[model samples]
Each structure stands twice: as structure tokens, then as C-alpha cells.
Target: MALALALPAWASHPGQRELIAEVVRDTGQDPAALEALLDGAQKQPSILEAMARPAEAKPWSAYRPIFLTPQRIDEGVAFYRTHRALIEDTARRYGVDPAYLVAILGVETHYGRITGRYKVLDALVTLAFYYPPRAAYFRSELKTLLELPPDHLAGPLDALTGSYAGAQGWGQFMPSSIRDYAVDGDGDGRIDLKNSLPDILASVAHYFAGHGWVSGAPVAARAQPAADARAVPVADARPQWPLEQLQAWGYAPLVPLDPALPSSLQTLEGPHGPEYWFTFDNFYVITRYNKSPLYAMAVHQLAQAIAAGVGDAGP
Candidate 1:
């Protein structure tokens, strides 16, 4: 009788074999190869730790300074200058603001200076099997990563690196976002988000366009609440009320805006005191990228700063 072969360490992991079998059935990828790939993926505890304390959890006053700074704005201007033609052309192609494209890159990775430091495989596997809170979501993303064609990824599965949440490239796109929105802007027959600027910029713009980004539209406006302002509870950043209704509730935009426009009122703890903001449809669109209002605000403010710095020079 032939001796039974010993299963790999990863295969012994709970649910590991089931996941591999599902991938094999869905994608027709070789099971042996999938097992080998899983064998190479080491569970990362730090990824879980980072997830529990995300920067988005910070208060608005604390979070505001992380991405918005003089240095980041200056660097964004320089980055835009360096890739003016490609950025402008891509923005035009996708109907997105060029400054926003630059700002996303700046806030996500400091203009590609710091994409991430974790192996993509480890990050996904750890989150998928170990983190119970978002395990299903991570499991789906892990499956997507495994199913991706060779060209969609910048490198081999074992070699790819990204954020703790498994987001890749300068824009910090997850695997599903890569599948849905990533583009080969360079026309090189491959989408390399990490090393290719055309791919990176175009992918970000495509995501915004897919999420209904309105070009040349107001994102947010500071609101002056009446001394006897009616207290309004903001649940999420989605625009659910008309601007006129918000005014009746005592939150009025400091700038002129159409009363018919749909908007949401957001109150944040600012440096000095509570800050009121009337967020618009475009602002709601930005929240689609990251559910946190603070994140959207940071990106909006950063984009405005970069736009001011790049001024008449933008295309």
C-alpha cells in the first residue's frame, strides 16, 4: 500500500482547504498551485492591530492635519507639474478634476513615496480567516485577488505589497476595485498600478467617474448656523435633504448655493469648536471612495489646496 502524503501546513489550517476548493471550482486554477500560494502566505497580526485603530476613527481635528499640510500641498503641485499632460488627458478622458487625481495620490501615498509595506497575500489571508469583524469582505477580496489574471497585478502573487487592508498602488485600491475600475492607461497591455503612473492616475479617475463624480461642482461648503439653530442629527454623509430644508434647520452655506440642490449637514469637532458643513452631491460621491466623512473632507481640502498652488498652470 502506498503511504498517504502529508498535507501542507496551510492545508491543515481551518477552512483553508474549503477556500482552495472553492477557488478551484470557480476559477479552474490548479489546486496544487493554490495550496502552494497559501503555503507562502503568513498570517500577519499587525494587520489586524492596524485595522482596529484606523486613522478614520480619529476626531476631525486630529485627522485634518494628517493629510493636509504645507509640505503635502507643495509636493502635490510638483507632482502635478511633472505629470501635467498625462494627468490632464486622463482627467479629461474620465471627466474628473485633474487636481483631485493628484490629491488622491498625495493623500493615499504621498505621490507614490509610500505605497505600503505589507505583502498583499499575507494581509488578505490574515484578514480573511482571522479577523471576524470583516472576514467575509476580506475573504471575498482574497478570492478576487486569486482570480485576477496575471496582467492585472503588477507582479507575482507572492511578491505584491500593499496597505494593511490589502489596498494596492498609489491610490490604495482594493482587489475588487482593481477588477472594477483599474485601467491600462499606458496601453502597455498590462495594468501595473504600482510602477505605472498612467495606470495609477487613470484608475483613480475611473473610480471617481464610476462613483458619479461631477466635474466643476461644489463638494462642500462651510455653514453658519443660527444662534438658535435647530439641532440636526447627521447619520451618514449621503445627501438626503435639499439645501433649502437644511437652511430651515438653521444650517446655511457661507457661500451662495442653489436651494434646490440635494445636500447633507455634517458637524465636526474642529480645532476651536464645532464646525458645520453643508455637503453636496459631489461630496457624497467622494464618500463612496471611503465611507468616512473625515477622509472625504481631507481629500476635498487637499485637492483645493493643490489646485490653488497649481493655479492657471493646470490643464
Candidate 2:
């Protein structure tokens, strides 16, 4: 009865409500608390505004400046050194390679120094309740969150503690992904990604592995376009297209004799015409962390910068 009324706070979408109901039943959470959250969430305008400005919409030239600063590269290095053991162990365990993990951390939240200031409660609340375009998706995440394991006095809601988008902790696993992949790597029985270096490393490695990361392979390299490939339409400067598809368009191989591999052709507007690359499967693996080619590229470049012994790589 009361639970039926609370459904509106989640979303108008039928699927969203069902999932929420399932989680509430699964967790034994007071349906009333979810109602209260939805009641308060439906009133926040800031959350609505934030969703409209997906950072990926910016041009690659513009987005490039946001992350590829000399400072971020340096920080990526420092972070690598501090978490060396965990990173190495995770690489070995997941077969994902440590540099990729470090790069991902560097790009996602600047090594946790600035892991988005938004409270997870607020962002999820805003998106799930108000933003009809994506409410269904966010609401499902809320349900997944409520069903996370190790229920306690705190209940399953303790899963992720920050960001309204439901992406929290060091690597910012979305609620669903967090529940599915998070592991307590240090044997402490707590899968605390925010502060546990071991857990964060392992969780991230798990995530990449789940997304199909290839170990011991080049992510991408600077390349020129094939004469015939030059006219293919570039799609938002991302690494989504496969290599063969890109080659047909105009992107040439950067490494002369590396054989054919699946790749994406990115055309970021450079200072001159455009910066292009033939991205690989590993590059696609990075995008699973954040579904933006530019973001993954920034992280990859920063990781490379750190690995190359020419940058800061932070804590």
C-alpha cells in the first residue's frame, strides 16, 4: 500500500519501479525511507541541471585541455609509486597490466584527490526521480545498490557513499557494478574502495577484466591516415569502432608491422587539422570505465606519461 505510493519517487518507468520494489523486498529496507528519499529528491533542481552537461559532449580539443595537463601526469606517477604493490598484484591477478590501472585512476578522480565532490545520494536521487530520460537507468542502479551483500545494521545502502550518479569510492564503481565486482582484497572483510588501496586496485582490475582488457598489448599509437581511409566520418572522438572498420575509413596503422587488430579511429581536432589514432581492444577496455573515448585516451596518455618516467603520477 504505502510502497505503491513510493514508486513515484523512483520514476514513471515501470521497469524502474519493479527493480526498486525487488531491492526493497530483498534488503528488507523500510519502504518508507525510500519514499522519504524520493520525496526530498524530487525537489532538487541542481541535480536535473547537472545531468544535462555530460562532460563528453565537449569537443576533443576542449576536453583534451581538461585532463591532459602536465600536473595530472605528474600526479599519476606519484599515485603509482604509493600503490605499487597493490597495482602490481592486481595486474598479475587480473592480467590487465598495472599501467592501465594507474592511468584509469589518474583519469577518473585524479588519484582520489578530486573524485567528484557530488554526494552520491544527491546525484542518484536527482537522476532517478527527476530526469525522465535516464531515470529508469539510475533507479535500477539504486535497486542494485540496495541488494549489495553483507547486509548489516546499516543495511545494503552502505554500499557506496558518495556521488548522486551512484559512482563512488576510489574507482567510482556504479552501484550495480560495485555490487557485482567489488572484492575485499586485503583480507579485512571490507570492500572499501574509497580508502582501501588493495580493494580499489582489485575492484578496478576486476572491472577491466570483465570488460575484456588484453594484457601485453598496445592501447594505441600516433598514426597517420591511410590515403583511402581519410574520408570516414569521425564519431565524437571516441574509441568505439573496430580497427578494420577504422582502416576502411582512413586511419593507418601506427606500428608498421603489428598485424591487423580491432581498433577505432579517433579524429581529435588538433592545433592543426586533427589528431588521429588507431585504438585497440585495450582502448575499448578503458572506455568501459567511463564510456567516453576522450576520457579513456586522457587516462591512457597520462598512464603512458607516468610509465615513460617523464611525469608526476600523483597520490
Candidate 3:
């Protein structure tokens, strides 16, 4: 006979009560109401499963095709054309490249066509209590969600839906990101990242600007390794070495780049063979949105494709 497992009641579950208390104590919200809200959140095992298998875990050869599809590039162009005025205006205000902004939306949620399906409360609760690895981070996010003002959220807490990690809207912003970077672009007052295009575009641009995205700066360039190329150590995506140093290390840019530019060497296993790249400060900024070098490259390439399709329509 199969054994039946008993599920813990959320209202009395270990850590759940403590999390509710923390939020209520921090925000001075009604304890009863907060308890009720948390009680309603069902722990989703699938959320923990999804978190363990993020797409970023894949190799560049496999990951590149996921976001840099021709279909995504074409739709990004259409999205830009459809919202040209708003995208341009937001980019100009934030001093970010318009194409990169479109590419972020394209890579994040397929231009908002597929935001997410899991309930935000459930996802957060599951991660906060069950996932020991990032529990503290998700616990803080849960606290933030509980403390958020009504105007900050698009709908009721129980009805809020987003990514498996509890990120919301088109850009997949966490609660902290929404609190910090989300904007009220439409001028009606509240920031609606789901239904409002202006708010979404401006929020993404604001995030990039907040993370120090330098306008008109090159993101990354293909590099040709010398026949006797010396191996360069790359700890992370941050540009800590000068281009001159990298060139001296046996990697030369395919296109001419300022030798004084701060750069980091990135090697990826491509379909053909090993691909080398000289990543710049702007590339680091893209990684601020997502730390994966593969993700940053996809956004950069997709942005280039979209910009090419849009012609010389300067922002």
C-alpha cells in the first residue's frame, strides 16, 4: 500500500508564523490580516524544482538559441515599431540604448506575451520556507510583498501571478526591484508593469540606468585568439582588465576597439568551436539585470538584430 503523507497547515507551519510576525512587526501591518494572507499561500513543490533547473545552467551553445531566435528578433522589431514613441522617450530620459531596452523585454518575457503562471504568494512562500539555499533572500522578498502598498501591486496579493521565483510583470522584477526601479510613466499615478507599456519600458530603462548603463558604449566584441594565445583568468563578468592587457594576453578584437577600454575576456563553447569575446562595461551592466554571460550576449545580439531591423531610427 502507498503511504499517505500529511501536509503541514500554512497557518501553523514552521517558519511561516515567524515570517508573518516579522513582516507585521516591521511594517506594523495587522497581524490577523497578514496571517490570513500567508495562510492562503499554498507551498508549491514545482517552484523549488524550477529554481534548481534555471535555464542559465545550460552551455552557451544551447542557451544562445533559446533567446536569440529569428522569431524573437522579428517580434522585438514589431514591438519597437508599435511602441516607438514610448520606448524612445524612455530611453532618452534614462540615457540607455533603445534597442537594449527592447531586447531586455524580449529576453525576459517574450515582450510580455508570457509573464508567468504561478501565484506570486505561493512561489514566495515555498521558496522562503522550503528552499534552504536562498531562503533568506526569498524571506525578505516575502516580507517586502507583505509590506507593499496597494498602489504598488497590480492586483490583490492572492491574485498576483508571476515567475516561479515570484518575479512579476514583463521584466521579471522581484519585489525589491519593483520597489526601487518601477516607474509611474503613464502619469495616472500607479505603476502598472503588466498592462501599461510606458511603465514597463520606463521601469526597464530606469533599472539599466540605475545599474550604470553607459549610452553609446560598445557592449561586447568578438576577439580572435593568437596562435599561441596565453590563457587569461576570468573570475566573473566584471571588466577589471584593460583592452591593452587582454590584447597582450593573445586575444585581439576582430573590430578595432579603444585599447584603453576596460574589458573582460569571455570564452564560450560555440557550435563550431570555442568563441572568444571582449566584454565591456556596458556588458557588465547587462549582467546586472542577469548575471549570466550567456544571457547578456543573447540580449546584446538580439538588440543588434532589432536595431538593424529598425534602421537608423535614432532615439
Which pairs clash in the backbone of model 1?
A: none
Better of 2 and 3 by TM-score: 3
**Cα-based RMSD of the predictions, in order?**
2.8, 4.7, 3.0
Residues 1-315 of candidate 1 have per-residue lDDT tens digits of: 122234333446777888888999998999999988887788888998999999989899999999998999999989888889999999999998899899888888999989899999999998998899999999999999999999999999999999999999999999999999999999999999999999999999999999998888788999999998999888899888989999998887887899998899988889999999999877887788888999899988999988888784221
TM-score of 2: 0.82
The TM-scores of all predictions, comma-separated, are: 0.95, 0.82, 0.95
Which scores greater on TM-score, model 1 or model 2?
1
**lDDT over C-alpha atoms for residue 274 of model 2:** 81
Which residue runs does candidate 1 get wrong by more than 4 Å?
Answer: 1-11, 312-315
Candidate 2, after superposition: displacement of residue 113 in Å?
1.1
Global Cα lDDT for candidate 2: 0.69
Q: Score candidate 1 by TM-score against the native.
A: 0.95
Candidate 1 C-alpha error for residue 39, in Å: 1.2
What C-alpha lDDT values do all the predictions have? Answer: 0.89, 0.69, 0.89
Once fitted onto the true fold, the runs of candidate 3 whose alpha carbons sit more than 4 angstroms away are: 1-8, 313-315
